[model samples]
Target chain A: MTGVLLPLLSFFFAASIVSLGWADMLIIVIYFLLVLGIGYYLMHFTKTGDDFFLAGRKMTMWIAGLAFISANLGSLELMGWAASAYQYGILATHWYWIGAIPAMLFLGIIMMPFYYISKTHSVPGYLKLRYGESSRMLAAISFALMTVLMSGVNMFAMALVMKVVIGWDINVSIWVSSITVMVYVVLGGLLSAIFNEVLQFMLIWFGALLVPIIGLVEVGGWSGMVAKIHQNFPAGDYTHLWSTLGHFKDNPMGIQWIGIVFGLGFVVSFGYWTTDFLVVQRVLSAKDLRSAKMAPIIGSAFKMMVPFIVILPGLLGLAVMPGLVGQNQAAMTGAQSYNEILPLMMARYLGPGLLGLGVTALIAGFMSGMAGNVTAFSTVWTYDIYKPLHLAATKREVADAHYVKVGRWATFIGVVISIGTAYLVQSAASIMDYVQALFSFFIAPLFGTVILGMLWKRATASGGFWGLLAGTASSIGMWIWVRIDPSALRIIAGSPDAKAMAEDMYRGLWSWVICVVVTIIVSYSTQPKAEAELVGLVRGCTDLPSEGHLPLVKRPIFWAGLILVAFIILQIIFW
Target chain B: MADEKLKSDSRATDSPERISIWFFIGAVLLVYGIIILIASIPGVSSPEGAQHVMLADLHAGIWWGALLIVLGAVYVAIFRPGRKKD
Candidate 1:
């Protein structure tokens, strides 16, 4: 262990020695100032809760699409996936493709119209419209709490990156990021967050593009990377996507393709990409129903390419970086302790100016993620929680500006709470474990409930409430059972892997099954609202607006179809 | 009662004049240009006196900066505000 520690320490020391120059610092400062300026400039536009929370529903398809993906392009999506790529190899691309693409496209085609036509400010608001107060309150409170915790996770991740890369004190890193995020979010609300996210999206691509480009250049090209990876790690099948993924024992992921297909691709990915309010809020802010429908489709196109930016870096780390793939590193830190793969690559490949831009991209990713969470949290808290409670007590209608004021306060309070949560997460041995657990508890179950309510007119409000409760409870129970008796997971999850991610995927699948079953059983027993009452809320009952006289090629369906084709082509090529 | 409140609250706000997508694209180019240009300047150093290297040998910051500036100029010119009036 000490042998591993010594080398790891030496590696970190060597990487940290490459400090930022004056130009780098200047560029970072300019980036921050520009972000703040955007917030201040947009403040005039944010007059009411409508504008504050949903950008006055005036976002174009391009803005909505970029922001949709950008909101998810946080520290975790960047660093965690890169780390996964390094650890799990090309199999990590599944999270972007089979895991995300289908769900996002489904959302654009099947779900966005209801959300747009219903005109709800948040996901919880949608629930209240379709179900009742019970379901809405449960979802709102849980979602609000989860967003803050997720934001803290981003904060902790950014601080960890700074400590590893530049050797900054974690506390200073946390404070600087928290303050910067709080300023923009509080000043301009969702619009500011989305605008900055669009900018960060561009920066992430430009900055991280160098790694794969330069790394591929160094290794010759695509074929060269595969050959080098094969030579370096003879025991690992790093290149094959679906062919070698037949059984748990067949691949490094240590799970069957069925589990990957059903658990991650169907349950967890659909849960997150389709229902998670963080990305949904971006689409909900679109100028028109058409733009809202187009947003996720456009986002799916970009999301498909994300593996190159995130996963490719990890593959490069394995092929290039020495002492990263040995038994000691894997034993001490699962997956070769390649969490710092991204920063290490940046330190090595980027000269001076580009280096600053790369680091700024990291910062931008962290802040954008933090901002996404806080803005989403504030919207939910103010609209779904505080305002509803206030109305219940006062029995009066408050002005839209009153809600806007509450949103600002919520943003401030949310950031402070997130800062506290970030410190709390410091005690955890693994941040990824905690986050994945949170997702299983909240996201998967919520997806089950939302999908049922959206698709079926017969689903009762009481059913939605009880179904959500049962799903969450089952997920927790399964997690505890797995913890106490490691063997128990094998019954449901098929063969268990040593990796937590595989377990998480299986847990999500089981929880979703429980939720759906309970919802159906309870719904049949209870009285459902009449079809007349459920008109716009349920599919088949509602008449979806026609795609405005636009040509076939210009319509969202055409683009979505093209994306689906591209997805299949890539899968086949990678396979 | 709740439905009524939702209806009242969700009234569509007036549609503002369309802001051309080019504006955002131009703004991004301008920011990237400035950063690249500043970083490409010579004699920039760390506090420890380590010199910074240029990103590329072809005066990358200068050329990219100039090109982006021109592109931004063209975009802003073509899609300038109040073009609908014309």
Candidate 2:
């Protein structure tokens, strides 16, 4: 421990970092108190497992909508994407725009009706409704493992950021944050997490918006920033969105338009935004079908604006603050890492009170992220895993209170495991990367299984089970194959010069295709369920709820169309 | 029918009596805004750390803080606990 502490202390000390003032400290303390207060307040209302896991299905559109996006807007995403913008240029906006908006809108306009109508407690629960037990258990086990590991990743990243930015001890940051999250989530469950996520959304926008606002002011404006970037790197075309993507080697990111469109836009984005339970759970808390559908649409609208605070800072760094380098280079030469661009910009512009708010926003982001994962983990554990085993043992239904009790315990145990995972990540950074990638491996295949089960009535239980298994296996196999032989990248990504990001996109596309094809083949060979059993589970058999009485302006499809128009306009403007 | 039953059952058990989430958001923002406004007062010496940033004279804290206070005020007024819904 002493040996680890010595090197870590020296590394952080060598970096020039800022300290917080009294006002900053006061603001942060207030936020911590407020979150815990929310938990205590909500504890009174939380009696059943429904209240603990699904917020009693009573969240308004705006509340659920803000939280739906906020759950994804973590410090890891904020810092990582900002760094990507700095390194890869405005092309990074593709992740927010093309990659996310389409899928979110699809979730609202197309997919949400099914999820809302089924009234299943979870995505895995829906799988059980449609396919059978095996598929649900597989998904639940994978989701539970991934969610807790991700909570740990968020915890470790928060500690690392605090240590780098304000010189806080790693252990102190990790434990304080983990304990805070555990207290609130164990107290009130998903509602507590949702409340904190909404607060986090507001704080992130208000706290970080100044960077892009002041940055654009300092660099003249968008045109000026673009010109300055062009001047800085005469050979690099950093500003154009789609114009530079004629070939893999044409852009700094080494990705082509095809990968952007099909791989990321269709496969990876849909898999995450549509199927991933963490974000989906937020929308599931909506009071009605319209609100549920509107939630993801509202989320997409907010998501489209995230690039201004995130990607704009990285672009601004390129225009103004040069000399930021890659991580290994930064460590070797005492230069700033691109990942530190967000904090460095905050330091450059924000003063005492605002600095504290900025830092608090980051802390809120990390905590909300941890809370989201932990709460989701607890829900899946109790509903999908623990309850099943208990029922098998007792052969009887337990009281709702018993499951609620189990959820609280699961929340505690999940946080403890996450802490252990965080410490493990601290020891081996590579473990964090693999865990994140491993989580991604499940997403594409899961999306395929869920979508097929929802859309096609012929999708058999065996087909859903085997298809998901094969898809996940193939994704892992491809990852290992590429890791073993560097030359396999040409076959996987279709370009010799394609970067790691492109590899991820293509991998998702292939795995999803494999899952779909296998499901069709196996589904044909296996016995299909009777039409009577398919109601409310598969699309054609289910009579979807009608919102035709709503005005055009109030309809989710209308707003989805408008959002799509705005999304296209953004692409053209950025291009 | 089942979905409606679930919705009404859950609604009957929760919703109306609980404290509003918006109130908490408003309260936090209001306090933070006031703190920031106080810190940004003219002739208050700038912190040792922020002395060198460009546009220091622009006083972004004042504008942002005022915006927050106004937004916070509206949220608190509209959604404060025990206020009757229209």
Candidate 3:
């Protein structure tokens, strides 16, 4: 949710930016009907808890792969990153390339086998297997709370975007979108969510691709774009990716190389891609081990192409619409906010039919994001929190049918809670800033604990729990410290010129470091679990399945290597 | 017991009656492509119909709409559910 709204919190629009025609309204209405139709069609197949939670563990590689990438391709990401590109130039592409591709490939090649073989339903379930009940409980409660709150954040953000973009009423946007998402999700669960995500993925590409295509044509081409930007800001460097990163003040983003490399590329990116259950749940639905292993590789291939639609449009805005102001100045001077670039570009280029398609695509992005969060929230709430608590209190195992019923109820309840959160956010806008900050506290430390438990046989359960606790506490402490004293940003980010984004990266790095250090120290002091009990859960004790007998073209490692080569080539081309 | 049940549930997903997700994608795209293609015809006849966007002469709606139609048709043909052999 923070990922969707973090860059957009400053936006405050006084009037509608664009008006939609009948063609646009028709396209959006068609999208709503199709999603609900999918849910109603799939309802018959959603008979058991497994089907509702994990898509019956039966998705093909292409389906799961597309859904995995699409789940993260929310409207906030599209608009927010486009704004970032306008604000920071081509440096924003780093968030897509170095920040995402490596982490996704790492998840596919290094981390997937354990997750696939263990048959864990969620990330917290994996923790339960490796770190005991207490660790699982801690991870599950925090994750469940965070996921629902984030859903609410996405909901409110979508409503706000609608009210600003086409003058839709905020209450109408909130209720209509919320009810549509709730009906589909409650009817079909994860399968419905995954299916809609795939559809949303296609819609986003088709609807938004024209903006860059038209923008590039107007500016001439790539060289023409570079020249126009150069003409616009002669003293600043916007076209080059790596040349201006020698110092904090040298770059438009005020970020240094170390923060980009370690803080974002290594810590924050890995933490989100490798461990976030909203995305990982999609991969877990793959039919077999090989499919699971290949899914993220497929996702990364598509992920590399996303910057063409997202980042290029922002850079194009910088070239074509050079006088856009920051949100603060926009409110005072009545100039366009940088956040309005995507819709502005859409309105500038798209005609009647195409304009409708673009609007539908934005709506699809928002709903897909909402469905992803709600589905993941319901699964975690049911499996990790509710089922365990019910078992402990009643001392009996529930029937599969009963659990499936409970899951449906959880789905409905989760959506209601999310709608409530959206209204709360509407009443108090500053809640978004606090919620976004609170989200960063868990991810880095959770990654540290999970990765340690998976790889190191010596990591004790006590170490995992205590390390996670300490890391989270310290992250919150650091956020408060920086909040109370603005000068503390320099200490945290390692430079006086460091900006807000740099502070985030550096804080993630420090929290992760604290987690790893505390885990090792505590593990050495505690008694280790028996080696016999570690089979199938840790690296050395488990025998990995062989794929060497297959042809070279069929191996996951081959595709991963190909993706790595593509990633490096992109870096060189942009450099 | 729960694990065993989950393993068994995987078989249910392969039921012959289950519809392919691709077919829905293809169907939606085909409908959208047809509508846009028809809509672009008026634009081609009168410049006023194009809404005065950049590159109005290129008739992007015609090309883009035709491309979606062809792609959507192919996906529908290949992945249509209820076919016995799939």
Candidate 4:
């Protein structure tokens, strides 16, 4: 009874807020239909575990490229990204430009060389061949855990953002949206994921692109925003860039550039670009070896500009409501909560007609990310863990053969778990932060072990096995320290208007250090494994594409050029 | 297929072809370096940085779209798809 009536009731409420009932309902219904219809259509393309997991390894670099971009786009980006940029100050801005851009190129030029040569369906399965079974299983389990937890975070975020905008029950938003996203995602697996992502990317890019342009025109002009920013902030507040980083009572901006650029950025950049199943699967699904390698770079180049779509609006929103945003401690924490900034801004500002599109843009972003997450989870589980442990069919795991049906079921289960988790995740932190904090527990450890396994052949099975355990435990401990520490948690929980620099440092710096230190120490203490077995997995003869890998000579040339070019560009910006 | 192979960035004629890979990588690196340099500057700000952050904000469409076209060109060149024996 509630299921049918609630969304309808919510639809009317949504319609009434903007005062255009039928048109908005029609747009939402049509968009939902289009997603389901296309998802079902893409499902027809799946034939085997590889087909389900890797889209039969026949995706064009362009489609795969678009899908790769879509994997990063989620409903949360509009609000979450803008909110973070609005609150976190400038250095946090490095993630998209410096981090994502380089990370993509690295994956294309380096990781692709190995993936193409090895022809492994799963990223972790390659680890098994390169390191041992222990590394493979450990990576696989960690990936599943990360995906499930991340999905919950995504669901909670999607529901919360919509609830704030439409005044709907969070429960109604979760199941309705999750079930809809799951239907198409499960029906086709990566095929559906790629298909939906292509559409989602197109819409999200358009939707986000529309916001600042519309918001700017509607409010006043570009200079008008600057005037407003000054009006809202104290005289000196709107004038300083790096001042936000230094302005913390407890320093909510986080530990300086080292933590922001390298520690936090490097760890996350590598984890998502290299090891994450979602983005890797898109690259893996590329039509040929060259396309797979090139896909990430293509996607990344596009991502450099996402800050405009995502982060700028929050900053601009402050310009709209100068007196309301508050300054000093509240303002800095507002910057830290980052994800809440976008939706609240959108709800508070924007005209009715544009509001529909803003909401639509947010929906597209959510679907794109959710589609990426569930698809990756399905592929890693069905291909790596499930088939190896329970099923004994070699023919089923091949590039094109026997496991489509089961793979779809695995995707469905992943979606269900995601919905359950989403409902459980609280609205305390912005969706991205809550998800990131949880995901870092799983991902940070995996990042440490993978770097060791890839760079050092002597990294033993027992070493990787225990290294993963130690990394995860340490990350969780660091998170607890930040929370339970009388200083940080009190500030995070809003009990006191706190001022502690070390407390902010815990949020940004400590987790990555803990993971890297623990992983290296544990891996170093273990014995070496047989190098001969890892040969075909990381370096093989058969499928090696002549063109894809970054040539040895090319590296130094690029590094030097990068330094020179960066020098000139900065000279212009600064001088 | 022959034309595709001939024009392909990696399709160098033996050692000369392999050497150009270095050249291509160098060009790409130059783009990245430009970005880093922009950030490394002493007083350059961001979107919400003291200045209203509008230069990159307002013109992102022009730059990212134009950059996308340039990247798209690289992709289209790679995607031309050659015959196996060519």
Candidate 5:
């Protein structure tokens, strides 16, 4: 204990000023122990593969909804978005609203019935049911790899936060967080992970709420913050959401509303919110069809408010910590830069005890993100990769206990590999760039295939496979083309001012277009499956039950409408 | 008979009908709130190793704690098994 304390003390001394007191440390320690305890306790409930992976298909709407957002409430959503807000101004909120809300609504209203009725364990499982083994294999392999890498990104981001705020060794932070996540997830599976996510969701709100509230007070109010931003950065349009977004050169984001609406909102957003198994898995865990549908709607409601916790801090950082941006300080040096805005705000505003909670909230965000990725990876590996191989070789169904064991082993192995990936991320130039590139490669094409297969009955299995392959290949090809000749990127993105993010959106849009066109042309040439065979898989072939029996307020459509109205109101207000 | 027993056991253990997560959350909030409130007293050692403190130091904990406890209670109340409609 003394040995441990000595190094920690020495590291603390070497690091910046100690922001946490003994009481704050006690609170953080207590929170960790409670999480571990919950994970261990939930393990006893997980007896089979279904229970382990899908929580016995018994999650309520609230649980599914909170977990859905919490799984995504990673350091990237909090810290990365805050950092983006600092850079791009309030225009970054479009990623939350236009980029997320409509897609979530589409998922709930249009996609849920297919996902729920099919009873597929994973997203690739859905592809297998809709398309064929070849498509399934392609998707499964890519998704499995992507999930693990994303987990590593989360791990890296978390370590970066700890290094910045607490002055801990990045490796130590990675191992500690990885081991904790592994223990809980390996023990209790998805249920424990979701449970902790819900807890983390609450803590995040509690921890981050103070920043915006205190900031608004200090800056006088919304009007005052706006005035400060305008006065300080005279050239930047930090307040307007859509009015200035006529073209790439017109706005701070350097992308037009077309990119925001079509690329991010339509292609990338739909691709991720609709098809990405990381979030969809939570909804799939819902006990009933209605609950599953309600989950994303609930999540969307919470998601609409997320810019408050995430982007507001960045805005405040702009007003308070002037000159924090454009510094490009190395993360390891613990220098206060734009990326450290969230923690810097907490350090300045939050006193000792609350500061502990704030730090814990950031840690919770990172851990939940890592845990969500690891759990998804383990499930995808076991169900999609390992089980398929095992079945092909043995030609037999394994016992539930056996699959459960494989899931646990996969979780352990996934975390270990993620630690390595985390180190790679640590060495990377910028984690945001790396993650966005991966998303364009995987998510954009996956969405194109999924949406086409779901909506178009004539989409052949061969078409699905080839189209996905082409889309992914094209995205990579485009990226390389741009990299080789910097001028080519200007042509591809349609703007000289297009940054990496704008380039990503354009790439997603072009890849999606390529995917859809290829799928249509190839599908016409290939043999199509019978309409009867495609029932429940295709949109028009299936008949969904009327939801009219429910009360107006209780209905998913009603909530979706209310959310849409709220969205319109926000757009108008910010316009 | 054995198969029937196994099915019944599985059904019973599969998923809890009532929500208990809020209860746990409430308990955590109550505990944290009490601890912070206790520590905020004049005699308790400040985490920053200071002898004196201000109302702002304890303000966040007390208020946030109270809010959490209330929210947890509301969740527990609303989600308790008897209130759930099929």
Candidate 6:
């Protein structure tokens, strides 16, 4: 704790003085200090990389679930996601009720069995155990590539919003957002992330849950906006929801409904909930297997409700923004940075004092998310990579002491690299689109390896390794193929790419198929590595008799049950 | 019935741990209810643009209704039918 206590004091001293005269800043400061203080205190708990990563595998299920949900829900989930509403409309978040909710519930019942059964930290660790060293290495590389790299997106988005609100320079906001996040995270590791998550979660919910009813009154209530909506966008064209809920009706996003659901919900959610390192680190830090599985499951269930707070605000925002409202239909549609839309509304509407509070809320969200990521980055490096090569300590011995100094250095180094890379990537344009697209690059590719590695004994590491490369390349290739040579894809896909609608439908489907095919082919060709004591580990996991080591259920009842439940939920959401 | 006795010293692996459904529901609902009621104090909705309604917080009375429904579903799902001991 002394090791943690010293650095955090200096960090807090610096952050407290960064901004001026914000009463809310003081409130946010209290939160910052408490989290930092507790995080520093808990450094006593982190003995090894495992403790740092999984809270020494001692977190209860409730804390694990809340922390997991809160970490995911940060500014990205709240402000940025709701701002998606501000930019587009409720249709953006309609995915929650339809796509996200079903995905989360299904994740708990289906994926939990595999994850808890593995008893590993991070998805890559699971691969290493089931597939082999080769697969583990690939999974790690892809995890770093997808999860770590895409994190720059959220950081960049938070910084951009700060620029809009306080008129702070983007680069300055970037630095402030990055440094503040690393401050507590480097001090405490996952404990800091978890503790801070408790506070940050409350702030986001308060912020998200606040905007709509207030906005509704400002916008002339639902009735006033109802008139304005009809005057501008024409009947039923403004929202897919108005015409037919959850089904697209001439919306510009043009994403096919099926693609949106499966690609975003199943593949993307699976990757994030089951595989993505940042999210996984949250689950990994859980006290035990039940907490790990239930964290995401419950987290997803919590997340499913977020649309009420975020997405609905966008529809409400339309009534207020001069850009979206006018005397006539043609006037409402025009060019603007939708990213600026939310902050602009806040600054214009909330008055400077309250506006400062909103900025502080975003900063809190930004810090919480950044801290979670830094914790994940540090955990993987120390546990998965460092301890394995350098230390000869026994597992129990490894599990019982403090490594704060090493952990802090890991965080500092990760932050520097991330900040440097984010600056380079800033030129790409549209912070939300760029980051999301980049996220898709890694998450889509690794989804196959994560699932196969868990479910099959034959999923050798060499296969896992090859499968990851193939999946990543295949996904990237699909992206490029769609953009550059849609014509070339027509032959392979047996659909004409010249048609925009065809291109849209094919892109999501092809990405999924390509990744899956490559993983299976590569996995099948590789010689299966005889894992050391495979049956023993599996038996120990299910706690079944030693002979069969078979799964607890005779058939795929759990997965089937989940799919049925998902179908039922989807029916209600769509019906 | 056999599964009932096989308890461990782990929150993650043990049988369903009871969560405070009331506290969770009450906190979110109470805050929202108070806020909406206060706003309807007939003065919080200041006319800024086309017309404006300001909420010091996000929660409102309706949010209580929504949360109760969701929380109820969550409670029903997590708590299984049977109880057991270590």
TM-score of 1: 0.90
* Residues A217-283, model 5: lDDT tens digits: 8888999999999888998888889998888887877888888999999999999999999899999
**Winner of 1 and 2 under TM-score:** 2
Q: What is the TM-score of each candidate against the true structure?
A: 0.90, 0.95, 0.95, 0.73, 0.92, 0.73
Question: How high is the CA lDDT of each candidate model?
Answer: 0.80, 0.87, 0.86, 0.60, 0.82, 0.56
The pairs that clash in candidate 5 are none
lDDT of 5 at A71: 93
Give lDDT tens digits, candidate 1, residues A1-575. Answer: 43454444334333463476555665566778878887887777788888899987877777789899999998667888888788888999999999999999999999999888988888889899999998999999989988898788778867877876777678888997798889988888898898889888877887778778778877878888888888888998988889878777778888778778999899999999888899999999998888899999989999999999999998887788745643356566665357778887777666556677788888888888888899999999998999889999999998888999999999999999888878878887476466647755978889999999999998999899999999999999988898898888677677655355578888899899999999999999999998887777789789998887889976999989999999999989998
Better model by DockQ: candidate 3 vs candidate 5: 3
By lDDT, the best candidate is: 2
* Interface root-mean-square deviation, candidate 1: 7.9
Question: Which stretch of 10 consecutive residues in model 3 chain B shows the poorest summed lDDT?
Answer: B2-11
DockQ for the candidates, in order: 0.14, 0.30, 0.28, 0.03, 0.16, 0.08
lDDT of 2 by residue, A497-554 (tens): 8888898999999999999999999999999999899988888998987889988987
Give one digit per residue, the lDDT tens place, for model 4 in A1-575: 43563466565354212332232344355557777876676666666667677777766665677788888777775565576556543334566665566667767766676766678876787777666777788788878878877888878867866765666567877887778888887777787777677767755664456556656875688678767766765533432333443323423453344444554456667766777777788888877766776577667656756766776676676676443333344556643233456655554443322334456667877888888888888778876787787545554434334456667787788888887777566735555565666666666566666666665666667767677677667667766776576665544423343334333333333444555566567667876656665554443322444432677533423543453355346334422
lDDT tens digits by residue: candidate 6, A185-238: 766677667766755675566544455546776667767875666565563444
lDDT of 6: 0.56
For all predictions in the order shown, the interface RMSD in Å is: 7.9, 5.2, 5.1, 14.4, 6.9, 8.5
Q: Write the per-residue lDDT of candidate 4 for residues B42-65, one digit (tens) a residue.
A: 223433421322233343333433
Give the poorly placed runs of model 5, Cα more than 4 Å off: A1-14, A327-335, A427-436, B1-19, B39-58, B69-86
Candidate 6 docks with a DockQ of 0.08
Question: Is candidate 1 or 6 superior in lDDT?
Answer: 1
